[model samples]
Target chain A: MRVTVVGLGPGAGRDLTGRAREALEQAELIIGYTAYIELIREEFSHKEMRSTGMRKEVDRCRAAVEEAVAGKDVAMVCSGDSGIYGMAALVYEVAQEYPPIEIEVVPGITAACGGAAVLGAPLTHDFAVVSLSDLLTPWEKIERRLICAAQADFVLCLYNPASHSRPDHLRRACDILLAAGKAPDTVCGFVQNIGREGECAVLTTLAALRDTKVDMFTTVFIGSGQTRVLNGKMVTPRGYLQREN
Target chain B: MRVTVVGLGPGAGRDLTGRAREALEQAELIIGYTAYIELIREEFSHKEMRSTGMRKEVDRCRAAVEEAVAGKDVAMVCSGDSGIYGMAALVYEVAQEYPPIEIEVVPGITAACGGAAVLGAPLTHDFAVVSLSDLLTPWEKIERRLICAAQADFVLCLYNPASHSRPDHLRRACDILLAAGKAPDTVCGFVQNIGREGECAVLTTLAALRDTKVDMFTTVFIGSGQTRVLNGKMVTPRGYLQREN
Candidate 1:
């Protein structure tokens, strides 16, 4: 029996990759966060499912591995790319204690990439992705990363920007970038519920994003020094064709 | 009539997202670099194709927009995520000069994300992606980003690592990172021809990767201080469950 860790992309079924879709279809058991399971349930109702709430990642991974070891094809689903703040690492870490099983990780369109498409090309150049959620990582560490990335002029892609308990994390992150010399007028944008219901994108500035209310479902893109607004879309040039000779 | 900038997702057809496939099927004209055009020719042969050689990005984008303006459903193909070092920005930039046309950028699996999965979750934390090619970006700026990212302890994903004209860029970038105080034994890996023919992943240390030969098709991952080799996979913990209390 084999285990495939699949990234469900951002939201919509069409956003899911053919490879990932095939993996989920072939799985006898599919496990994921409750919200993610509900997202796929309508399309894959026939597959056996084990759904858990948030913060139960370790237990969820263990469940998938046990099912795989029991001779059932299993797929552990996660939103966005499984390897990026998703379940890929946890699955690998937990599978260490389980019986030998063939494990494969199928990549998906991460929020950074998916949200960037909706906002034009905000990540055309070198960029950094830092999740603002402090659930697992220390706040100090997250702050340090935000400051360093901003100082380095790396376009920042902030994931897990806000939650019920972490309402102020995104604002604090923006302040750190501003303190690191990012201009207040620097172009920035965010997309809420990308590729799903309530999908919307707002083009704003660094200062505005700091003040705007956002939620956990949003992916914020803070542009670098070179980012600009073109016809209401944010874009960061790759620095190749536009360079002065 | 619209322009859909499609990301082919690494190199495999199955890796292509359903959304991208639909865009290609609806495209009356498909245009891209010669290599990328040939890569998808078998599946998309029915569409009229316009292929060009390297460094003709502006010309290729102009051709796509022109076709779209002429009432043709156009799809401009890019190798990875169109927004990340791909043609999304160029498409938007060029489309500005033509007649108003509805433009949509389809996201795909960028090389860094796709290659990371093949090598096992090397991008599980805060990370930065910098292309080593000096074609559009000045070498001095590239070096600065490499040094800054290294100093910040951010895992570095090097794209376009080597080309015929700049064979020494990867080695020099590694030197800068090593000089920035990164440990010599840091876990580093590279995937060549990701999702395509001749796909291969090499796991090594930072010091060893410095002396190794690479090509333009390779995506090199320099692990952060938190990264490790679990079993045979390069894994970087996200610091959630593995954090010190």
Candidate 2:
């Protein structure tokens, strides 16, 4: 038996890819974190559900792998793309203890993509995706990433910028970028609850975003030096109009 | 009328999201580069299609915006996520000359995510995406990005690593990564024509990848300091089993 690891996009419904949808439909059991499971419960109501609470990722992956080992086709779902800050890596780690079972990773639209669309096209060139939550990684590494991305002039897509555990992480990251040479007026944006109810995207400057309050559900974007605000939208051109190719 | 910018997701069929598929079905005219249009030609055979040659991006966006201005519902397609190094920003730029017209950017699976799955989970942690092609951006900028991302220990996903025009670009990039402190034995991989007919993924050392031949369609991934090869699949752990979160 095989366990199909699927990405459920940022939220639900229309963002799900045809292949991911088919994988979910074919699975005999659905498994994910409690909150992510609830997002798809209405659509996959007929399937058996298994979920674990926050910070219980090991349990969730182990349970999913054991289910697959017991001859059940399983779908281990995650919010956004499964491979990026999602459960795919953990699942692989946990699956190492079980008997040989195939694992398939179905890519989905991650917050970087979903959030970028909502705020226009802030990632139209080279970019960096950094998460500011220091729960797993040390704060120093996170600060280093922010500094390097800013120094390289990469458009930045930041995940977990702020959460209950650390409300000032975004603020610190902004300061790091500023010190690393990112301009104060650099275009930035954030999309909260992307592809879900109450979804909203706000465009602002890096200096302004430093003081903005956002929760865990928000995805933040900081533009490169070439980024600009056009028609009330965030856009970073790849210099196509300068047109030399 | 509206011009919907849709990402075709790497290649055809199963990778297309429900909303993107719906947008294409509802559009009166589908526009894209001649190559990307052919990727979906068989599936959307019944629809009217308009495709431009390579380097004619401005022309393609102009036509799409003009078609939407003429009251036709249009879908302008890009090979990967439209907001990332794709046509959405250009569409918005071109639309600036026309009367106010609604534009919707529907996200899709980008190459970084799709190729990461094929290679097993090289991007499990924070990462940087840099395109080696200096077609639009200067080569010096690309070099600086590679250096900075390496110095920061960010997992890297490289796009357009090589092409006929720049056959040695990937080699040059590998040298730059090494000079920036990335170990020569660091795990690296690439996926060619991801999700397409002859798709293939191979894992190698950074030194080995330096010598590998890849075309424009390939997406290359370089692991972070903590990344390793697990069970023949690349995995970068976020320290979940190390259990500190």
Candidate 3:
């Protein structure tokens, strides 16, 4: 018996990797956050499911290990790439507490990458990725990190930017970036529900982003000095050699 | 008769997305660089292929458009995400030069995302992405961006850091980063042949990366100040909110 930890990607169905599909198909018991379970509900209607809401990740991971130890193939699903702020670490954490279980991690399309792809190519070079949530870390630390990333002229990809109760964080982040010398016209992109039914992309300037409506599901990309808006697509060239014969 | 530009991912078949797979199957004429064509030779054996060596991307893109205009479903395959320093932009460039042709881009796993996933996680926050290649852009500008991103503490992902002809660029970039006050112990990761046969991930520090062997196939990630090495994996935490009990 083994446990395959799979990433379901940013949204439902469309972003499931081939390996994730295979793992899900082979799983006798599937465990994940409720939202993730609902996202892939169609594929596992017949399989035994153990779904929990957020903050119950630790318990869910333990259950998957328990099921695997009981001789059942189990898969714990996470949104986006499993290793990036997903269930892979949590699973490993719990597995260390319990018995050792054979674990396989299947990566998926992360929101940052998916958002960058939709925006043309804003992630062409050295960049920084940060989340605005202050659950484990203090907001002051997150702000300091954001300031550092912005001053570096890095194309920044921000995850978990805002939620219902914390809507002001994104706005504050935008303010800090502006203060850090990021130009108002800096190309900024916001993608919502990527690879899902309402998947949409908007290419705007940093100034415009502050006033834009963004929800928890949105992943934002703030382009650097090198980033440009060409034909409505935001692009940052990686300087690959072009032949000039 | 439309052209569907597809990203074949970092190396070969394993990295191709489901949509990319479908696009290849429907393509009557597949056009790409020889390496990309060889990567998926088995999948497109029956299709007419126009393979070119490096630096011939513009030519290949032009040929693909012409073939598509002649009522053929043509696919222009690019390694990594189609929009990120891939052939999608070139296809659009050539298509503009010719008649207006319908084009759809099918994205695949970019090397940055794939490499980051393999290293556990180093892209969970606001970061900057820059390239070291100065073929299309000047090295002075690349250096400036690197210095800026480093000062900002943005996690940096470098594409095309080194090749057979130009190997010192990555070392120089590291020097610029260090001069900007980035610590020597800053977690840096290198992934070669991601999602392909010779896949290898090395977790090291910035100072060590300067001496490491890197090539065109490698995707390098220099972690932000917050990034750390845990259990042999490079991880960047995306702050998550915890509900009050």
Candidate 4:
């Protein structure tokens, strides 16, 4: 039996792709982090579900593989696009250790896109994405990349901004951005659990972002010089022509 | 009646969000360019549809506004995210002139995220997105941004890389990138009609990218040094700890 890994795509049930829906429908067992399973829980009623809490990704993925090896058509769910810091890689790694388990990845809308969409496409131009989590990489490298991206005027999307232990990284990143010539007026937006029931977006300037409440569930966007607040919405133009007469 | 502008979210049918699906299901007149209309044609058998050709965006959007003014629930469809170079801006522009029409925007998954998913999250770190389309903005600005992003080593995603009238832009972009110290072996990816039936992804280097045939339908990602090709798949390391055994 084959296993399917599906990205729930942001938070909305409809954001799931047709392929992902079919995979979930056909799966005898659904396994993932609690939040991912909750996001698409309504889509499947008959499937057996296994969910783990935060920081238990490895465990959850391993369990999914175990279920798959037992001849169950299983699906591992991830929020947004599964490959973008999702379960796709972990599953692949685990599969390598457990032979004979066939798998396929069904793509979904990532948080970066979800946040960018709410902010009026600040990423329409060249940009960089950096997660603030230094669990693996040194904070020095993350800082250096932040400086480089800021100086280049890249539209930056940050994930894993703040957890219980890392409350200062986002603040530190803002400080670095300020030192790199990104103006205090640069548009900064944060979207939390985009497309979910409590999903919300905040639009502010870089100087004011420090006062904003951010958490591990938030995705932040730092806009370029061209970013502006238009009628309460943050927008970065994509340079489309109007055929001026 | 209000006009709910829905985004199809990439090319897949399931990428449509719950809000977008509900809006479409409730709409009496569905209006969009041909490609977007074709995406949800099966869901609109009983609804009235007005599909326009390319370059007729303004006209189609105006018609949608007119329909809304006539007290019809209209769904104006856009591919990818509605706000990013989609019909959202045009709808707003026309709505200002036709005050009777009210509008709401529904977001979607953009091509950047779709390409990033296939390329193993080159966007995971800091990145920049720039459009090579000079139809509205001058090429000088686009060139400067490219140079800046390349020098900063920001993973870069380029939209509107080439079209029938501007085939050399992608090649010129590669030249500018080379001048900025990006290595020739730097992993670069090109995806065309991402998530669509004819989707094609090519993983190559910066130097070889200049020789590739790219069209407007393509989104090209030039990865940072952190990006690498793994078993024929392009992957940008997010520095997430694999497992410390």
Candidate 5:
């Protein structure tokens, strides 16, 4: 049995890598979250797909492993790179029980890269990615990371910044950055819907981002202290070129 | 006239995104480093190709912009994501002198994403990427990032780990991690020539990584305290589902 964990990239089929497309073509069973499964179904309509609702990641992963262990080629799909906040880890943990299966995690264009492209070169320097979901990790830990990254002057990519259950997470994260001494005028931006339809990018400042309306599908980028808006594009220069002579 | 900054992905043609391929196909002239120009020559042979040696980034980007402003469709190619340590920023900086040209930055598979796939889900949690090459960036800043990331427990993806001129950079980086209280047995790994020929991945510990031989094309991954070696795979669990019952 062989199970392939495929990252579908942001949301566009054009962003899908050849390896991911090949994995889907080779699979006898496809499993994923409802939205992700739906997104890929148009192109992979002939495949057998099983999708579940949110928060059922454990159950979904177990099912994929069960199908793979039963001598079927399985492809588990996730948005962005499977290794980053995707389903790769849960799939591996579930597959441990049903051993003797070959598993390969195919990388994809994560939200940070996809979003950065839409907003310009906001990630051209050393950066950190933190999830503000606060469901699995303690809020205190997330706050600490935000403050540390801010103080270190690292560009930050914040994932899961806002959802229906937690609308004020972005504001709190911005507060932490502000308290860490980041300038209110520091360049910042957000890409909502990423590569999917209705995609839009906003180039703003850290102070403005505090009250920016965002949701689960939004990917927020907080620039480093040296970030700038040149020709209306936000860019964080690579340290070498930005350093004084 | 349009100038598309294309990211050729790590190395393999299949890793290239559709949008990047489209930009190349639409381009009448392509500009890039000698090695990268050679890599894409077979597919884009008909286009007028201009290649240059290393350490001439400013010169190369200026030529591409000049061609674009002269009413030619141009593509400036770089390995990995064009925005991440690639040519997007350079292209933007140069194109600034000649405004009114459409420039699009097409993202690609960066080393962190491409190499992480081969080494399992080592980047499942918050992470940081620090380039070990001090040619452009001073060693002090690199050392500071390594220490801060270690103290914050951010899984680190180290780029440009070693070159002929600086073979001991990786070792010194590991020493800093060790001094920052990271366990000597903390999971660590590297991928050489990721997504291309001669690609190899290693699963080891921080102590062992100190002596590992690496080169300019290598990408090193340093696992956090929560990272573990399971079934020969390096994995850092996402905090949400990793809480103890």
Candidate 6:
């Protein structure tokens, strides 16, 4: 009767919100990217699953819309929040081509939040979420965002920092941050695999992060000018205690 | 044994992830701001609850840490994601002076994500999250962040957009954005009381939003250059359908 676009959080079962789990549990069919499907394939073993390979976003969404239009209750899952770099917008866009159907978006914890927890609180203040993937956006635009975010001293959460086609993108982003008046020693961190196995988090300077190689599964964080490393954890104070003085 | 910082995800029980609920249910005491405590007090009526009034973040977190250090498992709840403008960082900062007690941050659906879901997929691309309140952070710093975020065309999710002391902040920010070359017709939206009683979502333009006064309870979304309104919903495309050509 309706299509629910669900965000499954970063990874692992515990991160899934109550509503997201309930939607997935009640859905007659679940659809998403092949890798995202693999995340919950075991949890919802009884439900019918449909998936498509990478770069097949449009087709995947169309299939979901078609199924929903045919009276099948569907849940299209995405990693992180379904509304952030996920399938929620595409579903709304695709659903326009079909009969009217209710579309509900179930929000989940995105990488910025999940990774921030593992690396301490680098996003307690104002921040920007940028993706280095140039497959869809131009590198020049990405460069500008890095510069602005750095110049303004906003904590930066970089997504899709590296990929096969853009293996050097993380380095390039780091360079942009460095060039945009950000100090080379700015506290930075990256988390790999998030809640899933092999999940790892490391803290380093902006200079060191440039040399560190990470895969597509990694999420990177660059601290603001006010950020600091205390007790080996990177944290950007919200300026509450300081004002208490 | 540990202090679990949980994000309540807007203001609804359905928005609480399974992990967050479990933490609250298992905790011996739940602590947070007075309003946030009231949000989940009914759901976990069996648990002991403690809260502090506004601007008492330090006292509140210190209390939570004291409770945990005394061997009672405690959960500190925040309205949105505990990491973003939440108490996760403050807890880590306060725990430094005391004995090393386990500090775990359970990520929840932040306002940006929860508000985006109600307003449609306006944050499907990269964005910046900025808070207008300058109670702790100076006003000048907030001004620069607004200018830079607007110049870079990053979709902006604004928190605490207006308050009694800063009633003109949102309008002032819009003036800066307009001065920074953002179009007056730029798509914008705001959601009040997200996921709670009297919840309302409105779609407009930057020009209109500047005049639409909002309280701290509202989360405002300003679209990037690529954002649009389709079928009465605001959406910022990830450039998928366009790239298919």
Give the TM-scores of the predictions, in the order they appear: 0.98, 0.98, 0.88, 0.88, 0.97, 0.98
Question: How many clashing pairs does model 3 include?
Answer: 20
The whole-model C-alpha lDDT of candidate 4 against the native structure comes to 0.77
Measured with C-alpha atoms, the lDDT of residue B187 in candidate 4 is: 94
Fraction of the real A/B interface contacts present in each candidate? 0.70, 0.80, 0.34, 0.36, 0.56, 0.81
In Å, residue B157's CA in model 3 sits off its true spot by: 3.0
* TM-score of the A chain in model 1: 0.97
lDDT of 5 by residue, B9-126 (tens): 8884888877888888889999999999987899788889999889788888888899989999999999888888887876777777786788888888889998988988898889
Candidates' C-alpha lDDT: 0.89, 0.92, 0.78, 0.77, 0.87, 0.92
lDDT score of residue B24 within candidate 4: 86
lDDT of 3 by residue, B105-177 (tens): 7777777777876776676555666778877777887787788677667778898899887899999999989
lDDT of 5 at A149: 87
Q: Model 1: runs farther than 4 Å from truth?
A: A240-245, B243-245
lDDT of 2 by residue, A166-192 (tens): 999999999999988888999999999
How well is each residue in A1-245 modelled by candidate 3, as lDDT tens digits?
67787877777475666767888888888889988899989867988888998877667877888888778899898887776677765555455555666777777777766777676767655566778887766788778877877765667888888987788888899999999889999989989988777888999998989888799989999987878776677777544323332
Off by over 4 Å in 3: A65-72, A124-126, A226-231, A237-245, B69-71, B124-126, B225-229, B237-245
Name model 4 segments beyond 4 Å from true: A1-3, A65-72, A93-101, A116-127, A241-245, B12-14, B98-101, B117-126, B241-245
**Candidate 2 structure quality by residue, lDDT tens digits, B16-124:** 9989999999999999999999989999999999989999999999899998899999999999899888999998888898998999999989999999998888888
lDDT score, candidate 5, position B205: 94
lDDT-based ranking, best first? 2, 6, 1, 5, 3, 4
**Least well predicted 10-residue stretch by lDDT in candidate 4 chain A:** A236-245
Task: lDDT winner between 2 and 5, please give it.
Answer: 2
Displacement of residue B92 (Cα, Å) in model 5 is 1.1
Order the candidates by DockQ, highest first: 2, 6, 1, 5, 4, 3
Residue clash pairs of candidate 5: A136-B240
The sequence of per-residue lDDT tens digits that candidate 5 reaches over residues A1-245 is 87799988998488888778888899999999999998899999999999999988888888888888899999999999989998887777777777678889998899999999988888887899999998888899888888778766889999999999999999999998999899999889999999899999999888999988898999999998768786777787775444423
Task: State the number of backbone clashes in model 1.
Answer: 1
TM-score preference between candidates 1 and 4, better one: 1
Between which residue pairs do clashes occur in model 2?
none
